[model samples]
Target: MTDPWNPADPGVLRLPSGRLVRGRGLRRPLDGSAPTPSYALYLLGRQPPPVTWEFRWIRWPDFRLPADRAEARAALTEAWERAAGERVEIACGGGRGRTGTALACLAVLDGVPAEEAVDFVRSHYDRRAVETPWQKRYVRRF
Candidate 1:
């Protein structure tokens, strides 16, 4: 199955491997017209509100990294793999810092070089993604 999110949809980021994942901010109002993701990873300080779709919550504070690095990796890898067929999404409170970092990491899993993943996400997803220095470093080391 080659089901994928529409490239023109809000927050959609097409990875180098041709996998599509949407990145969004939970703090903002979700677009009612937008398609819902089959699976989503929420990088947030606390558990997100229950949604109709399946989701995993990673304890990632705003402007910070995941509390459990190993778990984050596993969850990110799951999201990346699922993106091959499912409509995967990566999200956070503001969607630029934590969300961007996760997207960059996903890029790495999708065959993008770790060093260039941040740039790739910024160019295609959000101009101000991967907000902090540590976030960029994390992507580089991912």
Candidate 2:
């Protein structure tokens, strides 16, 4: 049987360097009701089979990166480095605040002005992204 999620949907982003990543909300269901898979499983590749690209997750909540900035930096760095070889995704519960924050950080590593990352995401991803005040603050810091 064919799946309906369509992994190649617009929610996915491909940077200039061919890195593909998708932002998602953890609270949301995978097939509409099932539990989310393991972070490693989600990032290593798509579900089922045919692993198209590698992935990794950054477990940011509504408005916070990992308490350990070191871990957060490491994860982001690894994602940045792996961008050259495979797709890297950073997701959260709303795909807006947290995901957008992570994407903005990626943009910073990609040379986007730290000041403009939030606007960049607003223009490209969703105007509603970076919704929370803390989310905006996080973008500036990144």
By TM-score, the best candidate is 1
> Estimated TM-score per prediction?
0.96, 0.68
- Cα deviation of 67 in candidate 1 (Å)? 0.2
Which digits, one per residue and each the tens of the lDDT, describe model 1 over residues 1-142? 5468999988999997789999999988777887888999999998899999999999999998899999999999999999999999899999899999999999999889998999999999999999999999999998
Off by over 4 Å in 2: 1-8, 16-18, 30-59
lDDT of each: 0.93, 0.59
Report the Cα lDDT for candidate 1: 0.93
Q: For each predicted model, how many residue pairs clash, with residues at least 3 apart or on different chains?
A: 0, 2
- Predicted candidate 2 versus true structure: per-residue lDDT over 1-142, tens digit per residue: 1122223665555554445555665455457553222222122112323323444444444555555556677787776666555434556666777677777777788878889988877776767777777767766887
Best by lDDT: 1
